[model samples]
Every structure is written in C-alpha cells, then in structure tokens.
Target: MKERVLDLVFLIGVLFKGLDGLLELVGGAVLLFVTPGQVQRAAERVTARELAEDPHDLVANLVVHGAAHLHGRSVWFVAAYLLLHGLVKLAIVVALLVGTRRIYPWAMAALGAFLAFQLYELIVRPSVAVAVLTVLDAVIIWLTWREWRRGRELRTTWRQTVAWVFRRPQPREA
Candidate 1:
C-alpha cells in the first residue's frame, strides 16, 4: 500500500513535469515570432491594471521591468533554450509513460544533468523559484531510480518463475 502511494506520487510528479514541458514548448514557439517590443507592450497591457491598483505590486513590477529590458539576442537565446529543454523533457516523459525500461536510466541521467546545471545557476545567482524547481527535479529523479530498481527486481523474479514453470522434464533412467 505504501509502495502504491509512492507510485501514485511519482505519477503525479511526472504529470506535472509533462504539463510544464508543454507550457515551455508553447512559450518557446511563441517567443520565436514575438519581438521584444511586442513583449514589453503585452506586459504593460497586462500589468497596467494590477500596478495601478497596488502601485507597489512586486510581481507586476518585476514582469514590467523584465520585459522592458529584453534584447533580441537574449530573447532568441532564451527561446532556443526553452525549446530544447521542453522537447527533451517531453520525450523522456513519453518514454516513461510508455514503460520503456531502456530509457529509464537515461531519463534519470538527463534530469540529473539538468539538476546539476540548476545547482550551478543557483550558486551564481540565487532565486527561490529556481531553487524550488531544482529540488522538485531532484526528488523526481530519486523516485525514478527507486522505481526502476523495483521494476527490475520484479522482472527478474518473474522471469525466473516463468523459466522454472516451463523447464523441460529430466529423462529418467530405467
């Protein structure tokens, strides 16, 4: 029962990862076509009301500030990064969903690499959101490792049982 619950949690985590990947995929594609000026305009349009209401809204101000300083090169870099990251994540999630044993270790390794990169980013420039994401990614990787081992053991035991059941009978000497 505990294992079942853990499995459920793992599934939920994977689902969230897939959803996040989907969002990144869409955002990256959209960013490729949108100009920095357009992004700033949209940010101003969206945050105008909120900023006016609060006059000191942190989130709204941050969005406006970030959008204001966007450069064409920076935008392109970010878009490309997001596209690659999202595509890799989506592929891993699909393999995991389809129960591809061969990809489990590879997926975990890829995620671990991403986590290591995130850790380096944190060291260079810390952000609470990034920290949280890094932690979550670590947890997911650990869960995947555990589940893969469990599945491997189960498969080995199952194969042994099947072989024993199907073994040819020994010849009896009269």
Candidate 2:
C-alpha cells in the first residue's frame, strides 16, 4: 500500500511537471508573436473581472501591477526564460519516467537548485504561484530521493545474492 501511494505521488509529479512544461513552452511561443500591448490588454481584462468578483483580490492586484510593468518592457528576456525553463523541466520529467538511475541524483540536484531559487524569489515577491511550485518541487525531490535509495538497495541485494550463488566451493577432494 505504501509503495502504491508513492507510485501515485511520483506519477502525479510527472504529469504536473509535463503539463507545466507544456504551458511554458506554449506561452513562450505566444509571447514571441504577441505584442506587449496585447498582453497588457488581456491581463487588464482578466484583472478587471477578478477584481469585480473580489474587490481585494491580491492576485488581481498583482496582475494589474504586472501588466502595467509590461507596457514598455522587452519581452524577449521573458520568452527566453520560459523556453529554457520548459525544456529543462520536460527533460527532467522524461528522465524520471525512463527510470534512469544515474539521472536520479542529477535530477534531485537540479530540482533542489530550482527550489532554492524559487524560495528566494518568493522571499522577494511572495506570489502564491511560486509558493505552490516550491511545495510541489519539495515533494518531487523527496519522492525522487526515496526512489533512488530503493533502486540502490535493490541493486546491492541482487549483487550479493548473485555472488553468494556463484561462489566457488573450496577443494573437497580427500
């Protein structure tokens, strides 16, 4: 039952990671073609709707602020950021799903680094999205570490069993 639950968690992480990557990729591509004015206009519409529903919605306020900041900004930097992030995430998800033992440690390290960055960003910006992502990354890191340890133990046990079975018998001729 415990193993099943762990498997489920890992599966959910994989799915979420893949979806996140896809969204980033698509968003980046869209940003390449869409003008900042268009983005701001869309954000304004969404923000207005959200604020109408909740007069004091923090996210809506953030959206308005972000849109205002985007008005004259160069979006290439953001586009590049999104594309790079998306590609890395997709690669990690694929590696994990393929059960690459050597990749496990690297994956954990990459995720840990990203998590640390996100935590730092949260400290500076304090967004709900970043906080949720940090939590998800923490869960994935734990699950990946657990799976890596289990794989190592299994390999060690198999080696020991094989060695014992194939051991040469001492000379018994009397």
Q: Pick the candidate with the highest TM-score.
A: 1
- RMSD values for the candidates in order, in angstroms, are 10.3, 10.8
Model 1 lDDT, full chain set = 0.81
Q: Runs in model 1 with CA error above 4 Å?
A: 52-62, 152-174
| TM-scores for candidates 1 onward, in order | 0.78, 0.75
- Worst 10-residue lDDT window, candidate 1: 152-161
Output the TM-score of candidate 2: 0.75
The candidate that wins on lDDT is: 1
Q: In candidate 1, which residue pairs clash?
A: none
